[model samples]
Target chain A: MSDTSLTIRRFADLANPTRFLALSARLLPWICWLTAALFGLGLFYALTSAGDYQQGETVRIMYVHVPSAWLAMMTYMVMTLSALGTLVWRHPLADVSARAAMPIGAAFTALALVTGSLWGKPMWGAWWVWDARLTSFFILFLMYLGLIALNRALEDPTRAARLSAILILLGFINIPIIKFSVDWWNTLHQPASVLRMGGSAIDGEFLRPLLLMAGAFTCLFLALHLGAMRNEILRRRVAALRRQAARGALTAGGPA
Target chain B: MSLDAPHIGFVLASYGAALAIILGLILWVLLDGRARRAEIRALEAAGIRRRSDRPVDDARAAGPAP
Candidate 1:
């Protein structure tokens, strides 16, 4: 077989829920421990890192804020891919992935908003601002919440999956807007520093801790996303079993 | 969180909020997994076996069952 077909077969193998459950079960503990280790190391360095000449100790907030903001966008990007899997490839686990990621994405977005607010108070002298970046991010948070509600409100899994996949794709337009909002408008939020055109403009002292925290946050998201996907598979199994039992009862003239 | 640090309130609050959110997410994932497993176990205890749990032959014999 050609390489493409071989890779496709491997991908198809993982699309099976049982295989996914087994794989996630084997991987979860290692990922969990790794997440813990990264967070511990990241936090230690973030705290011990030298104070900023101007921002001082509050600059530490960036360690958490920036990473959360990045995850908020990155998680949605993952969901967008899953949405494509649902729509085009018709991958069974695709909607499961999109659904599992919603809450995690929302949590990270909320973290970004809250930390940004906390950072804003001292730096921007406002608890909240209607700036371009901030407003766009808030909308992103609302989008996550709205999609999550849609996922729960729909009773039929197939219908829910299809509808959400479309909505997820539609909502993806906000991501780039959020990324470029600072540049497009005169916002209180600073323009991209770490992920910029040329290179990161941040000084090494602050950038090291920030990058480390970003790695930790990414690992945390990975572990959580896998756990969530496993739970979703279990949920589908339970529902299927219930339906099976119901059918069995109707046929056998007894309660399930 | 340092006592002597400047703008300690802001720094502490940011970290505190991040910690609380992360802990909440972790707790929710763990609890959700436990609850779903409990649900499956309950169904099995009530004699409602998933199709996959049955033997391959049994599954085939019960072909096309939901």
Candidate 2:
């Protein structure tokens, strides 16, 4: 654990069961408090301050809907990076980190789909569409589901890690397509407003709360992710010990 | 349309959905952490008890009795 090995040390800390448990003990409470405060403020802003000039009160939906959608995309990208880390660096935490992120990502993706649908019904006169943005997002959701299912189905942890990592990497291709689909083709889904060639399409009044809510959501994700990783590390350790005990019992009962 | 005038049900639904998902994730994390910690404590206790029994068993097996 020299200075040169600090990166390795950090990885080991994350990978080690007891170390992770100790670290998470100090982390979870702060994360929970920060997440609560941020969400509270963000909700207040969304409810009290934001109002759509054109879309009217309904525009408040954008605060939650937009941030969740952004997080959904961003979460996939993170999982992909973790997947690569697992493959190349053989970082033990990488697999558990990626696995821990799946359900959270899936939930965000689902929220995005549902909220987008609610928004669309009023704006587009329809609840569902096969438009490019929507379709690509649908693919993103399926990818999350696939990664989760793949992780659970394998018995060997390392084998499961490798397989799930590969799946996450492959599925990440959908993210860029989802982001750019609106511009590359004519789709019912609107083009990027908060981000654009010139500037945001949103006004200052609305943008402020939207940005705040997004920050809150990102913090919440980080907090939840650390907690989930702690649980995964503990579960892996328990499972390994049980396996070792079972093998010992078998060996002890063998013919002399 | 005025600021107050528009379909409001959709807005309510979006908020509801966000709340449901976030709360569910939080509950899952808390419950999982509690259960894993309990398991770890149990496993450690078992390991300690087993270790304590080992020396006694070894001494009896190596006893001087005929």
Q: Give the top-scoring candidate (lDDT).
A: 1
- Summarize candidate 1's per-residue lDDT along B1-66 as a digit string, tens digits: 365877789989999999999999999999999999999999999988877788899889888843
Clashing pairs for predicted structure model 2, backbone only: none
Per-residue lDDT of candidate 1, residues A1-77 (tens digit): 99999998999999889999899899989988988888988998999988888988899999999999999999999
Candidate fnat values, all: 0.84, 0.71
**Candidate 1, which segments miss by more than 4 Å at Cα?**
A254-256, B64-66
Model 2 DockQ vs. reference: 0.43
Candidate 2 lDDT, tens digit per residue, A102-187?
99999999999999999999988999999899999998998889888889999898999999988888887788899899999899
